[model samples]
Target chain A: MSCLETIQSYSLRSIGIGERLLPRSDFTLCEQVVLIGSGMIWNVYFGLMALTTGFFLATAIALGKGSANPWLRKPAEWFIFLFRGSPLFIQFFFAYFLFLNLKGAYPFFDPFTAAWLGALIVLFLNTGAYSAQIFYGALQSIPKGEVEAADAYGLSGWSRFRRIVWPTMLRLAWPAYTNEAIFLFHATTLVYFSGFPAWQQRGDALYYASYFADKTFNPFVPYPILAGYFILLTLVIIGLFGLVNRRLNRHLPANARSKMKLRLNLIR
Target chain B: MFSYCSDPDTLERLWWLSCYLTTGVHFSFYLSFLKVIGILAVTAPVALAFGFAGAMSARSQILPVSWLGKAYIAIVRGVPDIAFFLFFVIALDQGFEWLRHQALCPDWTDPIRQGNDFLVCPQAKLPLGTAPQAVHQAYAFALAVMTFALVFGAFVANVIFGAMRAVPKAQLETAEAYGMSPRQTFWRILVPQMWVYALPGLSNLWQVLIKATPLLFLLGIEDVVYWARELGGTKTARFTAYPHGDWRMWYFLALLVFYLFMTWGSEKVLSRIMARLTRGQATTGGEAQRKGAPA
Candidate 1:
């Protein structure tokens, strides 16, 4: 089939549309590209929703970890440690079983077994924990003078944080936050592998790529195609984060603001 | 297991669990914790060598050699590492087999790539397809170790490369003024100082390496996650001596605590090492140490 015909047939294939069965024999480059590209839709969905939702929770948890009260501080500290310390692969497995038991106990939790909601929750918590640590570090490093100035001007708790602290902390945290977003997006590839069945072969890019590899016994084509898609996605993330970074740091004297570059070191 | 544990179905809760925990597979499950530690112990030094080579080459005066080093650092790190793990295990296995195919089957004219089958002479099969179980496990493990090393070495190279640059340019210049060769300067001046700068990144990388050990399950090693699933799944009475309901949550919880203890202990040990390394250096930690030296 022509590339256009193939796209039409498999554009929504990851979500289980337009085709019931995947290509089984005589695999084409076009088919691999289309199906894998189609699977990227799920990656985008998981990353986007989890990142957006996780952002607020991350901020709250960061604040909690920084708080003076041990009641607030200890739980937040443990939450971050529990998620950050363990492998996210095991987190998915652990969460699946927990949800399965919960579903058995309550009929309302039946939807929790499906990958879409259940897996999204895991990614959300995982990213939230990681980003929280970055934010906590950033928050701690906020200059003493800034908070002192706000306090001297009589800016109290919430407003002091809102006005004097939050923006600066974000500015400091932006580079690492950008790294976290890129990692989280890349991490979406793991959900399918982590006990969360794709349900009718509806999986992310690596899933489809591996499917083709299993069928054709040729690792060369499909995996590289998947990597190409990821490279594009990674670039898009960097570009978007870079743009926001520039805008956020625009007011800082050029030398004072940190420049965001793509750094893949030590994502956990 | 006590005498009362002989009939587990008839036994009460405490006795039933005591007997169940002593099963033969549970012993294997406990040993797998050491396997995770084994990977960390072996991979750290091997990956360090790979990183040192990568960083050294990237710093080389020769352009192509430098580019090779830079590309190695970039490509493995640019993508999610798990993808590399998935790709290389199959690719490396196939590559070894293909080489053996060429070497062992010179008179054979049949194509190795026949449709979907990677057909090769029987001798070309890795582990000879007739090797014992231990050899098969060892081969799979060797593949896992290589994949872990290659992926992590790139990250380490990035850290080392930055650390090398962070060394004062004046220090290298002094060595040059003293008529030291570039190689001598690197060995004496740059190599000694890079660790002080590299420690923070390496410590962080070490934590990441710890968390990443569970991905061994993905590489097809029957690591902790595999054992958890296998042992925690519901067991019918007919299947074995002990039958139980699904218990994966508890198994994974134990795994979670094990990792947390590891990371917590790692933090303590790394901090002590950092303090020792920071002595008489130029970084903040060293500055503080020098200032507080009277104690």
Candidate 2:
């Protein structure tokens, strides 16, 4: 097939759209590139969904962890420890098994077995737990002066937190949170590779890359293409988070503003 | 196994479980936990060596060598590390075979890349085609170790490079004032001090390394995850002495607990080490120690 024909056939293949069958043999370079790039839709989808939704849970968790009451604190602490302490790969296996058992008991949970819903839940919780830890640290490190100053202005309770505490915690947490975001996106690659089966061969970028690698018996081509897509995604995340970092630190003078640094590569 | 395990069907509930847990496959499952530890024990130092070299080269005055080191560090930055794990295993295996093929079979003119097959001559095969299964396993294990070292070395290099830069410039200047050579300043003054700053990152990397051990299954190794799945799946009465329904959930739960224990233990030990390292240093940790001490 010509490159256009190949793109037309396999462009949306990752979501089980255009193509029902993946290329079997004599796979062309165009086919590999298009199919792998097509698979990135799932990666982007998982990352964005988990991140946006997980943000609220993370905030609540951070607050709970910082709470003085044992009732609030213990569960939050254990939640963080439970998810953060174990490997995510194992979490995926254990979760899939749990969901499968749940489905067995109640047919209502049938949708939980699919990668789109099931794997997404795991990613959501995992990121929530990790980002909670980051945010909890940020909450602790929020300068005492900021809170005392807010108190002097009669800003109290929810209003005080809304105006003063939350922004500072976010500002302090943004850099590490950026690293977490990138890691989350990278982790979307694990969904298919784990216990969650891709329905009808609809998997993520790594899934397609490995597929091509298996077919061609050539690792050099497809994996690099996967890596390239991921690099681009990483850059996009950094750029987007940089914008937020700037906004979060906008109130501070430029000279005193803390810049976001992509300090660690393998955080998770 | 027990004397009564010979007739699993007649065994009582607890006894059946005990026998099931002590079966030969379960023994191998137990052994795979050691394999994870073995990988960590070996990979840690090897990766440190690789990272030290990478950091030194990046910090090198020479342009090309510095770029090479920078590239090595940068390569792992943007991509998911699992990609590297998946890529490196096959890539390294083929690379070795291709090099050996060129060296060992000079007269062979047929293209190695014939459609989907990587057809290296038999002489080029790692551990040789005639080698025992044990040799092949060893070779695969070695490749896994190398792959882990290469990817993790880059992360370690980034840590060490930052730690090296973090060493206060005044200390190096004092070393120069003492008539120490540049090499002496690096070895005697810089390397010694870099560890305190590097410790936190290294400890974090250690946790990451621990979590990453489960990926061994992806490398086709019979690690804990592999055995957990194999042994946990439904075992039919016709096929085996002890048959059970799908018990994968329990197996994975056990694996999860093992990892949690491993990470929790590491955290405790790492904090102790961090405290010891910080006791005499000028960092905040040291200052706290100093103030808290009996004066």
Candidate 3:
């Protein structure tokens, strides 16, 4: 089949939409690229949803941890510790099993058996814990003078936080937070490989790539396509985050604005 | 393991659980934790060695050699390491067998790639096919260790290279002015001071290494994750003694706790080490240590 025809057949193969069966034999370059590209849809889905939701949760966690009330601070501290200390791979497994057990009691949790809900939830919390730590560190690093200035102007509590503290925390934290976002996407590759089954071969990019590798018994072709897709995705993440980084630093002089470089902070 | 455990059906709930936890498979399940630890112990030093060499190469004056070292560091950071974990094992295995094919089975003429199949002569198979199960397991584990080392080594190289640059230029120049050779200055001034800078990144990489260990299951090794899934699956009464319902959640919870403890313990130890290393140095940690020390 032609490249366009191959794209048509395998474009949504990951979600079990278009193709009934994957190519059995006679593997072609087009088939590998198209199927893996289809799998990128899941990666983007997981990464985008997890990062977006985790952003709010992470902010809450950072604030909660910094609060003087032990009720809020203790749980926030433990949540950050538990998630950050454990491996994301183990978190995925633990989450899958937890969700599966919960499914019996809560019928609403039936989708947890699928990769979409279960693994996404794990990634959500894992990234939340990571970024919470980053934001908390940034929160501590905020200049004392800024908070003092806000207090002098009679801005206290929520008003001061919303106006002064929050923006500065984000400005200082954006560089590290950008790294966290990039790694979150990279970690999405582990979802299909984790305990959560792909549910009808509808796995992530790594899933489809490994599938073709298994079929062809040649690791050369499929993996590079997956890597190339990921690199492209990483570049796009950098671009989008760079734009936000710019807006965050819009108030500052050009020399004072922190440049957004992709620093690969090691791991969770 | 109790003497009263001849018949599982007759045993009470607590006894049955005790016996179940001592089964041979359960023993292997417990051993897999050691395997995870073993992977960490073996891979860390090996990776550091690779990192040291990589950093040295990156600093080399030769053009092509430096390019290769730089590329190694860059490419590893750019891609998701899971891809390398999945890719390198098969690639290395095929590479080894192909090398053996060319060496020992010279008379054979079959193409290694026959359509969709990777066909090699019997003599070229890793572990020789007639070897014991232990040999196969060892070979697989060795492949995993190598893959881990290669990947983490790149990260370490980045840290070490930056650390080397972070050392004071004045210190090195003073050593040179004192009639020390370039090599002597590097060994005395650069290497000694670089550790303080490298420690933080290395600690971060250590945690990342711990987190990445579960991917061994994807590499087809029966690591802790594989055993957790296998042993925690629902077992019927007919299947074996002490059958239980789906208890995977509990198993994974234990795994989670195990990792949390590991990381917490490591952080404590690493901080202590950093304290000792930073003592009497010029940085903030060192200054604090100097102040905190009684005269």
Model number with the top TM-score: 2
Candidate 3: DockQ? 0.77
In model 1 chain B, the worst 10-residue window by lDDT is B1-10
- Show pairs that collide, candidate 3: none
Better of 1 and 2 by lDDT: 2
lDDT tens per residue, model 2, B220-248: 88899999999989989899988888889
| Candidate 3 chain A: worst-modelled 10 consecutive residues by lDDT | A259-268
Residue pairs in candidate 1 whose N, alpha carbon or C atoms collide under 3 angstroms: none
Judging by DockQ against the true structure, name the best candidate.
Answer: 2
iRMSD in angstroms, per model:
1.5, 1.2, 1.3
**Model 3 ranges with Cα > 4 A deviation:** A265-268
Each candidate's TM vs. the true structure? 0.97, 0.98, 0.98
* Candidate 2 C-alpha lDDT tens digits along A16-105: 778688999988999999999999999999999999999999999999999999999999999999999999999999999989989999
Q: Can you write out model 3's per-residue Cα lDDT over B1-295, one digit (the tens) per residue?
A: 6788779898888888888889889899999999999999999999999999999889888999999899989888878879889899999999999999999989998788999999899999997989999999999999999999999999999999999999888898899999999889888889999999999989989988998888888888999999999999999989887778899999999899999999999999999989889987789989988888898
Count: clashes, candidate 1 = 0
Q: Across residues A1-268, which tens digit of lDDT does each residue of candidate 1 receive?
A: 7889888999899998888888888877899999999999999999999999999999999999999999999999999999998888888888888999899999888988788999999999999999999999999999999999999999988999898899989989999999999899888898999888889999999999889888877889988998899889989999998898998798889998898866875335
User: Which residue ranges in model 2 land beyond 4 Å of their true spot?
Assistant: none
Q: What is the C-alpha RMSD of each candidate to the true structure, in Å?
A: 1.5, 1.1, 1.3
Q: Which residue pairs in candidate 2 have backbone atoms (N, alpha carbon, C) closer than 3 angstroms, thus clashing?
A: none
